[model samples]
Target: MDFYLLLWLCPLYIVGTIVYRLFLHPLSGFPGPKLAAVTHLYEFYFNLVQDGMFIWEVERMHAQYGPVVRITPHELHIKDAHFYDEIYAPASRKREKYSGFVAHFGTPSSMVTTIQHEHHRLRRAPLNSFFSKRSVVQLEPVIRENIGKLADRLAAEIQKDEGVIRLDAAFTALTMDVITHYSYGKSYRYLDEPDFKLAWKDAVLAASANGAMLRHFPAMLAVSKSMPHWLLKKLDPQAAVLLEIQHMVRSQSVESLQRLQAKKEDNEKTNTAKTTNNDANDNNDDEQAKSIFDALNNPSMLPPEERTLDRLQDEGQILLAAGSETTAKTLAVISLHLLRSPAVLARLREELISVMPTPISTASWVELEALPYLTAIINEGLRLSYGVTTRLPRVAPTEDLQYKEWIIPRGTPVSETSYFVQMDPTIFPNPDSFDPDRWIQAAARGERLDRFIVSFTKGSRQCLGINLAYAELYLTVAHIFRRFELELFETDVDDVRLVRDRFFGAPRDGSKGVRAIVRGETLL
Candidate 1:
């Protein structure tokens, strides 16, 4: 009798839920596929089964249903660029992150994954100064040192048969080393690897590939996360790379904490000795060893709960993953287009030459930033790379959002993808063309095209590593292009196309990404 009743109740409950969602739900009036309104499996089919095609489905929804469409039962996606500010709002506005979207990350304690408005703010407060422009400018030596290593590698490659190289992998190696060095005061030294540690890049991509599936089935992610190392390796070799990365970061965090503790004890002893000796010269002026962990461990900077080893590990994971891949993709994009367009390449090379008089000449971040043509090319690359390549949903817990005449109720999840904004035909005419001149033309006409470039996103939760990314872009591009003459090798526009959205933009699966040959070294 119990079994029979349970079977009957399950169907009835499911049917009743779908019916209520279609006709009686708060978002029922909003236009979208009835199937999407009824269940998230509609999203699952596209993102997981169709391989990250949900973003395209959303675009089609906006095309057919209008700019504002309910993408999920509880979430609305607004395609209009004008409405972007209201959704991603400034620090003054109280915008919470949607937990449904954030839960997939498996990093609940990290600043990026924090769901509440106030809690995210608390987590992010101490990190601002570290990623600031001033800090990045100070860290320019680190950026150049890595870029110089890359240049040396490229220079050496010129001696090979075709001097063929995978710019995508090489760029990833460069960025990975810089970020790891920044995080732990020691780099993974990916740039030193012969194959540029392709497995590590695969691991990053694999983690992103799992995100869409995890979003739909968070319980599976939770279970997988808790599984022992041996089981995880058996289950999925690529996914296991994520665990290895986590363990490495956690170990670094523990070491940093221990070092901080030892430093405190040493300082206390020094003070005691000074008091006993009554020595005026004993005013110790020891500078602390610096790493992101050291800053995070400071008790005065963050509260006790926020400074824990667990919190530090979670933060480290987000920092390293966030800091690496996206910037590398942008560099790869810029390199592809530059190699394809001789005029654009010539113009940029001329500009770089003016600033850097010789092939091995060095320039400051400020100096590189001032080159107008170079800046324009970077802006174009960012527009195309589309940063996260997914619709980042934000929730307003306290106030209703106004989109045209529609009233989006408080606590409703709303999103505007950077893809739509970056490639809007009205804003960027010939949006598919890799034309840096669009930026230059906009500037001459006194139009501020920068507002449409949301690759770094906008408002309170914008990318924390923007300054570091810019520094890397400016330094890497200026150094590489100025020093080496690279040509496209078995690569074309399709090699850098935004084919799939694996959290970040991706080219087709089997595609060899953005390969180029070192023609020769350039001299002034």
Candidate 2:
């Protein structure tokens, strides 16, 4: 009788607690579903069970319950185009990343996962110049080289078989090669792979499942960072390839550290022999161009904590993955749209021909960028891609967020999605259609459509690889279109459709990728 009474009491107690949370919590006043107010598991269901559908569900919540709706027991999601800038504030503001997101980024050491505003600033400072516009422009030749290799391969294949190249595979290979070479002073040559059989891309995609699990349960992230390699492989075999890549990154970082240490010892021995301390530092382009490895290893610039071997490994992984994946997807999407829309392709090629009237290889990025129609096409591509297609949560630990009359308290997670913001019809008109002319027309009207496009997000936490991504897109688009006339083959809208969110959006119905045949002669 006593055991049965306790069981009945437990059920009653749970219900009572939930009733209190739904009706009497600090955020109870906020407009949202009663179930959402009761617990965060509502979010967990959509994100974990439904496979990253929570962002869309949040949008639906916004439709039903205004802009500011309680998404979790402790968090509020605001999907307002007008307030995106305010929500994702400047780096100067106290915008700490929500703890819920730390898992997706892999490690707390990476600046992307750093929570504190000042901490992120200190961590990100060392990497600023390496990814700057000047740095990327200087690195364009290297970019063109890998892209040139891809173009050559495609051209040769077309001549041999008149085959349809998978744009996603081609783009992924091109991007992976460029970024690996850029960051580690070597290329994985994913392009060099026959049919691009690099399993690393699939491995990266699978990690999205790990990310969702980690986000829902933070305990996994801690274990992931500290757990032994043998054990992780035992649990999930796919992690072996992922871990192999990370180990490769760690080896590069360790090599840089060793080189730095050897130089220091040599400097000391010289000073002792000569009885004089000559502190000489050389910042030549050769040393400067050694890739992001040496830059992050600089002791004077980066703090000791941020420069740990483990931290360096995490940083390199994030940089390589972040730098490559999004760019590859965007380029694939752009190529797909261009192939599908012949009129758009015709107009773009005419502009390219008018500007250079020569081969694509001979034309510099500066020349390609100068073409108004080309620039408009790239902008439209960025707008449509929505590269990181999920809600990025930012919490103001010291300040309350004001969404109209509602005062969301400090430490409450406030979030927005790139999907809905870029898809907002009020701002984009026909947001679904891939129309480059909208941008060209907007430019003619002097409208700032660029402000509304937040694929890279905004303010302090913006993507560091923006310049590099831009360089890749500009160069690849120019080279491919200038060299070959691409057209869709056995591929349709469903192949590239944004079906499920895996952090990076996945295509519907298991389409291999955007497949198209390569035609025409190399423009050069």
Model 1 lDDT tens row, 1-524: 99999999999999999999999998999999998999998988899889899999999998899999999988999998888999989989988889899866656688988988788887777678879999899899999999989998999998888868889899999999998888878899999999888777777877777777667877765677689879988986545766677787899888877877898889887676675566643455544437777677766667899988878888998888788888998999999999889999889989988889898899998999999999999999999888888888999999998888899999999999999998899999989999989889999999999898898888899999999999999999999998899999998888778888888868876888888999898866
The RMSD (Cα, Å) of candidate 1 is 2.1
Q: Candidate 2: TM-score?
A: 0.91
lDDT of each: 0.86, 0.80
Model 1, 513: alpha-carbon shift in Å? 1.7
TM-score of each: 0.95, 0.91
lDDT at 49, model 2: 85
272: Cα error in model 2, Å: 7.0
Model 1 clash tally, residue pairs: 0
Q: Model 1: which residue pairs collide?
A: none
